[model samples]
Target: MASPKSAAIAALRRQLMMGDGLSPSPAPQVTRLGIAAIDAVLPWGGLPGGAIHEVTGPENDGAATGFCTTLLARLSAGTRPVLWVTAHDDLYAPGLAAFGLSPERLIVVRARRAAETFWTIEEALRCRSLAAVLGEVRGPSRTVARRLQLVARSSGVTAVLLRHDEDDAFANAITRWHVVSARRDDAAEDDSDARWRVDLVRCRGRIHGEEGYVARWFVEWRAATGDFGVVADLRDRPDRPAPARMAR
Candidate 1:
């Protein structure tokens, strides 16, 4: 037996979740939108399969780079390869290398124009072997975004739309994320604390943590070599083992 209040609350929550409009009808096992607080924000705990996600903002370096890298790394966690389609060839190699990502996991393809970029993105998203598709365009239209969103949802791969400040359109996206990196500490080593504050500007039916929430990045480190890899786990992540320093 369920209490009246508790039952009513459950019903309401179910309604909200249903209103979310599930994508990738059957849902692809390989699709995951992002990690960290990002996964925590969405009602699904990850980007829905076959749905389009819009990542917008200015092209100022490091602002979107960290998130992009982290997002890709998470996508690669699955067996499928992630495709990064760019219009201007802006993907960085050193940054990626430092992330400890194997080149075999990421496919970087360059396109000359927004039109071609969108097509490439659509094709990649349609590929059953792909885990996710990253589409970067300069200035795209509402119709175009809607079309891609439809294709993404039908293809069963998460379409991560990376755009310059002017390009991203909000009309047809499953989620719109605005990412900014602030107060970066000089973490000379990997174990140091690196805080990334993410603002989930828009999520259709669920509550996003205040405007900015704390998501700590667990940077990959080579203790023996004194080097850094990509930012992978969230700080104080439940899965991370307790530091040996804290045991005694």
Candidate 2:
């Protein structure tokens, strides 16, 4: 059962999702992540447009990039142009293609500095012509994050913040997601599914329990359907011996 506060948030979310109880002509459409279980937990049935979302994963492992690419592929399905702002120039065009983002639909802006990258991201977010704007940033301050959120709300474009490490201090983002490469399911070696351990670290509009309602999901990407499916609920996974920390 949802708490009263949670219910109220759901109602407000519905109103926003339904165009603020007014004409629906100007309201942006919501895009489903193609995953049922994940959608069910969101305040809106799907990812709401005109909002900022954050995705983070282990540092330097490319996990964050992989997750962001998958999300971009889904968000760019209408063949809309997507602007990706990053200081790193290591993005491989071929690898992105595997995730369904073609070079023609992707515009990459390589910034020499993080500040430049964020400026480009905000500019792209304000462009109504673009479907989505993604930025690879780190240690984003609340002020900068709030600005991005504001821009996204007014432009009806989705702004995705891809962080390489754990930093969930931005309260302005609608949702924060953490993704990591999971141990491969040994039994499914022959299968084509790409497995990931996903965490819903925080949400703005939902009232969580005393423990703050963090949810874990074992998600797998099914190539045949081109969608994500929940293979297991990992909230209660058994504890194991901690691995040695890798030297920096």
Candidate 3:
């Protein structure tokens, strides 16, 4: 009962999905952050899947790792395992559990050199069964980054790069984030919450006039519920009160 034009369109869509035609494969869907305000500004309404994202922090600061772990927890909510590649063996499994990432759901790969680390990351990204891949590299060249981005897109897997210090811009990355620990004046001795100043330094496909799309938020990760709560959005006026906590 389908019309000729309609049926033709449907067949073309099928081919596209199956990667049978000349057109490139469809871009992976977006993954929402579960925060309305944050999602609203992004081009895809959230983090784009099948792309590379970068997170960086100051030396000896665990803020970047913590933030990346939070993202891994969200992405690996399903049964698929996540691959984490690093050159060092300093990762604490128990600490990761605080961020909702369990040892059983993670596979750690220790590479002896930076080249090996990137190789492992690319291989992991090619595996369709993995929920995501995280690589701890100081600074990857633009060529290496582009290669990873293409592989991730083709395999439909998310790739995250964790760095201890600032590096040159990665042109192929979908987003770049900077995180730093934030101090709370009023705090309890037993508080296990993690507070950070998260900055969205660069996001592709963002439209905010000529001012460039940069945003900052003071956020806290609740250890009990494994949720992220926004303390404040610095983009707003200082006098304005912070918004209510975002529901997961």
Highest TM-score scorer: 2
Candidate 1 residue lDDT tens string, 1-248:
79999899766755553344345235334334434334554556675666666676567745555566556666677355888887667667766755544457889999987788988988887797887788776656777776777667666677777766754346666567666544543555534333343445555554334323222333433424433333444443435432111100
Q: What is the TM-score of candidate 1?
A: 0.69
CA RMSD of all predictions: 8.1, 7.3, 6.9
Expressed as tens digits, the lDDT of each residue in 187-248 for candidate 2 is 64537467787777766554443333356677776666666677653444424311222111
lDDT of 3 by residue, 5-101 (tens): 9899766654543341111447466777766666776655777678888888886889999988878877887467999997788899999988878
TM-scores of all predicted structures: 0.69, 0.80, 0.80
Q: Which window of ten consecutive residues has the lowest lDDT sum in model 3?
A: 239-248
Cα lDDT of all candidates, in order? 0.60, 0.72, 0.75
Greater-TM-score candidate between 2 and 3: 2
Ranking by TM-score: 2, 3, 1
Give the poorly placed runs of model 2, Cα more than 4 Å off: 1-28, 188-190, 208-213, 223-225, 233-248
Query: Residue pairs in steric clash, candidate 2?
Result: none
